[model samples]
Target: MKLALRKIRLVVHLLYGMWVVATRFARVTAQQRLELNRAWSLRFLQLAGMRLVVHNDGARIDEGALVVSNHISWIDIYVINAWRPTRFVSKAEVRKWPVVGWLAEQLGTVFLQREKRSDAKRIMHELSEHLVAGHVICVFPEGTTTDGRELLPFHANLFQAAVSASRPVQPVCIYYEDAHGNQSTAPSYIDEMSLGESLDTLLRGTPLTAHVYVCDALAPGAERRALAADAQVAIEGALDRLRPVGARVRQAAARGQAEQDAEVPHAGDTPAANGPLAQ
Candidate 1:
């Protein structure tokens, strides 16, 4: 019953939020739009029953910078937006999503079709233009969502834009945790789960807490692949440090189990302990 009420409230809030953006987005200056975006993003996070926690290692660059992060869930977009209203580079398919797509468009997301190799060069040019114009651009170089337990390889093509524009690259890391501060999969939009299904899971689960860690910015001038590698290493290191104790324990247990299984002989193979060669 409580979950149902929360869902109803969120639905109404989303409708009203969209109306607010549609009506006022045009009349505002770029800075004003950024402020509005952050405000709306915060409210959306509240409605979704999520709290954001940020840890900044250095000053956040507002202009002519590229922010890169690991993609974990759909909510990562909003979580970062709430912190700073930077334009995001998202997959083309998100542009077709109903209300969420409309909101993303309003928030100035650049949609790229991953299936087309040509899109990469076009997107790199677009991102370079945005950076040169002093707009902070955020991209999830992983190009997709993950379960929050590990980091995927980041696509290096986008970093070329930052390098070309000579913009500083900031690496941010996000993790979703439960009320007890343990890593939680409740917010992950993985596999065949639809947006509605992911939202329902979030609404029914415990309140989520997002941990956003801002690492040191990498200076420009290196090649794209080098920058991508450095950012990935920084983010992966952050994840290792900030990931919940429970998640770490589970990972360790899984490793131990795999090792134990490997030690056991196959049905047709002689056991290590009993084989004639064991002597």
Candidate 2:
């Protein structure tokens, strides 16, 4: 009964949120739009019975910063935006989603077609321009959502935008925890799970908490691949700190090996390179 009530509230909130975004977002200043986005994001999280807990180690997210994080679910976007309004680099398919798509467009998301090799350059250029305009651009370098158990290899392509614009890259780590404070799989938007299914799972489950850890920022001018590798290490380290005692020891050993592997380039590896934008 309570789950059903929450679902109904979520639907109503979505309707009202979309209306406000569609109407007032266009006329507002950048700062105003950011505040509106933050407000709606907070409400969205509340409707889903999720609490956002952010841990920043004194690292500031400056304007023209490239904020990169590990992806767990669709709600990851809102969880991050609830704290800091950023221009997200999302897949092109997100632009076709129903009400959510329209809201993302209004929030200034940069949509990219992943199947098209040429599209990367176009999106990179777009991101660079946004950074030049002093906007914080966020990207999920994992390129897809994970189950919140491990970190995926960060793709080096999009990091080039920060290099092109000479913007610092901030690494952020996110985890979903249950009422017991253990890592939760209830919120994982993994294989074959529709957005509706994910919503139902959360709505029926206990309130979940999102942990956002902001790590040190990598200075501009490093090659994109190196930057991506460094950011991955930072995020992996943060996740290690969040793990249970026994798990933390195992994860630390694995992470040390991974860091060493990242330092050794494969024979086919090349320096950061950006192709011309698709015409």
Candidate 3:
């Protein structure tokens, strides 16, 4: 059974990856891209031996909005892609990663430098502009891969810019668990693994699962700091739903209020929420 599943997974990976590239050539509009994502992603999940629990409320994700989610395994990219027509905002260095990085660029991901404050400002400015023009940009607040179990404090800087953009902000939760429902402990990218080692690990006898919870979207005009804190709270809330055994509702409430009172000093009476509200 294990060998057969691994073989099936490899074939599906190739086919879906090809489909992603092929769709780009079709000059499909963003909506089309999103629709195709749902189909292809569901297929990938089935073949990869993953069961997906996507909690969405028909949230109307606005164009040019910023959606922040937690990062777990590299598969998070493909998994998220299945659900939306959003561009990923990742570290600039990811451009150098081998196969996956290549795909990210093809999908129009935005790259930002972490330590280069000035460059980061420029990237954020560009991101803001994109959102203004009506684009959905997705970012990982934790800034790195994790075991998909704990919440990482977010950097408020980027959230600040999203505030000025006046678009709805989304918080998404993600978790990857093994065959028996054990949260994956081997998927983090903290230590580099050779190509063969990684593939072998993925093909191991157990299949994993990915659960994504799309929480309420925040409206515009939140003060930068407040938005940052609120965003963290929203994401943590989504994660807690998946592991009710250790849910921390108070922690989420506190995180939600972190930067709220700060006020949107730079924001004028904002326009109506554009894409998806608290999507």
Best by TM-score: 1
Q: Rate the local accuracy (lDDT) of all candidates.
A: 0.87, 0.87, 0.72
- What global local distance difference test value does model 2 have? 0.87
**Model 1 segments beyond 4 Å from truth?**
245-279
Worst lDDT window (10 residues) for model 2?
A: 270-279
Give me the runs in candidate 3 sitting further than 4 Å from their true place: 1-26, 60-62, 192-199, 244-279
Runs off by more than 4 Å, candidate 2: 246-279
- Please write out the lDDT profile of model 3 over residues 226-254, one tens digit for every residue: 87789888877777667644235655666
Per-residue lDDT, model 3, residue 265, is 36
- What is candidate 1's CA lDDT for residue 23? 92
Residue 54 miss distance in model 1 (angstroms): 0.2
RMSD of 2: 11.0
The digit string of per-residue lDDT tens for model 1 on 1-279 reads 487788888778778779979898788888888887788789888888888888874568888999999987888888998888899999998989878888888777899998999898899999999999999999998878998888888989899999999999999999888888788888889999998898888777668888889988999999999999999999998887788677778888999999999987787877576665686
In angstroms, what RMSD does candidate 1 have relative to the true structure? 3.1
Clashes of each: 0, 0, 12
Q: What is candidate 1's TM-score against the reference? A: 0.87
